[model samples]
Target: MDVSQVLRMNGGDGDYSYSNNSLLQREVITMTKPIIEDSLTNLYCDMNFPKTLIMADLGCSSGPNTLLVASELVKSIDKIRLELGNSNEPIEIQIYLNDLPHNDFNTIFHSVPKFQKKLTKQMTSYSSSPRCYVSGVPGSFYTRLFLNRSIHFIYSSYSLMWLSKVPEMINTNKGNIYMSRTSPPSVIKAYHEQFQRDFMTFLKCRSEEMVRGGRMVLTLLGRQSDDPCSKECCYVWDLLALSLNDMVSKGLIEEEKVDSFNIPQYTPSSKEVSNEVEKEGSFMIDCLEVSQVNWDASTDHNPIFSKEDAQGYNMGKCMRAVAEPLVLSHFGESIIEGVFERYTNNIKMSMSKEKTKLINVTVSMTRNG
Candidate 1:
């Protein structure tokens, strides 16, 4: 399928549309802002010297969160400028926001004015004039992203789990035949292998693109436990199963087909991701922390029980959002509306039962100097 077709099949519109600014506010911006800010601070302290920094935000879906990363980078650069006593000199900042070509660049482009306005306000607070340039580079993150040794800092949020493409074994009709969530062990294994291949390529490509001693802060949807079969580890799988079951019950799809399907590889545990990073031998682990995020707090003022609950909640919605298009592709447009309706209802049910919430692992690493 073409990029546009792939986008449409994935619920690229409707709830997943970039115009749904509230998702960016509640889902991406609030969650990513502090992490980016804090990570930038950490990286700044470790760098031996400050220089013109080129930063990239991978998988920067069109929304307010796109600007949040840029904002944090500019702020961090300003802080670095103050420390160097170079606040008087114009500091050059290059910011690249990346995503698939079909992503809503118009929304991203439209927000540039507001983002600049915010930057203008913030820069006015600083003692020196900061020269900041922002550009959008559209492409996949699984492959080469930048020029060799070009980027100083890289940040990606909620993007890595997507495999380069659906696994080839998904269509085979062994005991079970499926693509992402319901296939047999071999299918799941194939998906994981593909994930490993794609992830390693991503790291290796970035390693070449990043200057020595540069840092990357990546937050991805992940499982708490090492076990791949654990419900917490596979919450998205469970949700997809629930949604598929509903489709079958409604006679929209075949039971055997639904049972055989598997989801694209995701929910890699902290250990799994760390192992891959270590094995790749391109980066030194600085900090790897897997904690749950409180997404309910974004909606209500009340504090949640644990980080895992919040993360599960947030992740569940994100999974549905990304999978919305897939469902449309497998099923038909008529079922798209009901699919989301049921999918969201399931998320609310899971939340009320305190079953799952948004969870993620934040990893910060620097290229071996």
Candidate 2:
């Protein structure tokens, strides 16, 4: 599958849309809110604060989380300006919402008027209620998206875990969608190598675009353990693979096709993340945190619905939002519903045994001169 062209959350406000099923992502954002506020404070106080603040949210997919970040940023800048007694400076906040070209930019644009109205209502009397210009920039974050020293702060949420592309020459990890305990060391190495290369390129591009002392806050799916195939990181994919294999046994899909399919994703450990930042030589890690997030945080389970089944169904919807497009691209759309139904059932069965969660890492960095 063409990762850049095919991978995106389900667009619009449909039942399965990412906008509707992104509570887990919302929790991640909420967990990292303090870090974001602190980073902006440092940007204003430690560095020479720019009257024209240039900010970008890389991989800002279409969802409430997209505008949530922008809105919080404007509030933070306004608060800092008030505290610094620069309320009359007339700050110009230019927020660039970035994602792949195929992302739902229209949905985001449609919500702008409401977002602006809400933002204006929140501004205090002391501040000039900064003028915010929001625009969509379509492209990959692994390559340059802006000119040199143009951005002051960059915030990305739950996006960097995706590799630019799946690793090359992995003919060994058969029947699995991601790294598994049964995967050979070569398969593990291949994924880590791909992640390292992609992450380095990401830092290089951001380094060129951010001014000296600029700050960045990125939250991505990751792991706490040194093991590459930890249950925390791989169980969700493993369950999905199990569902696919079940379909194969039922003669619903070709075994060979299952063998060839893999997700273009990797969950980095904290050490690996810090090592990359150190190796890239462009940014200094200010704060790095790993939060263990429950898989069922977004589930809307009720007394009428079995808790385990409801949680599984909600997770299925969440995964369907993010992975359905890619799965459809590879397997044809005929089996989409059947695949996720099996996936939901698998999750239900597994949750009956034990609960599973994901490790989300939020890293704050400052551009080094």
Local error of candidate 2 at residue 114 (angstroms):
1.1
Alpha carbon RMSD to native, model 2: 1.4
Against the true structure, candidate 2 reaches a TM-score of 0.97
Q: For residues 9-81, could you state the per-residue lDDT of candidate 1 as single tens digits?
A: 1223354444332342345445555666666665666664455678998878766667876887787778766
Q: For every model in order, what is the number of clashing pairs? A: 22, 0
Give the winner by lDDT.
2
lDDT of candidate 2 over 1-369, digit per residue (tens): 789999899999998899999988888888898999999999998766677899999999997989998999999899988898888778889999999999999999999999998998999852577889999999999999998999999999889999999887446688888999988788899999999999999999999999999999998899999999999999999988998899999999999898888899999998999999999999999999989888888787557678777887788888888888888888998898999999888887777788788899889999998
- Model 2, CA-based lDDT: 0.90
Listing every candidate in turn, what is its Cα RMSD in Å to the true structure after a full C-alpha superposition? 4.7, 1.4
Task: Provide the lowest-lDDT 10-residue window in model 1.
Answer: 3-12
TM-score of structure candidate 1: 0.83
What C-alpha lDDT do the candidate models reach, one value each?
Answer: 0.67, 0.90
Q: What is the lDDT of candidate 1?
A: 0.67
Off by over 4 Å in 1: 1-51, 124-127, 170-183, 256-261, 295-320
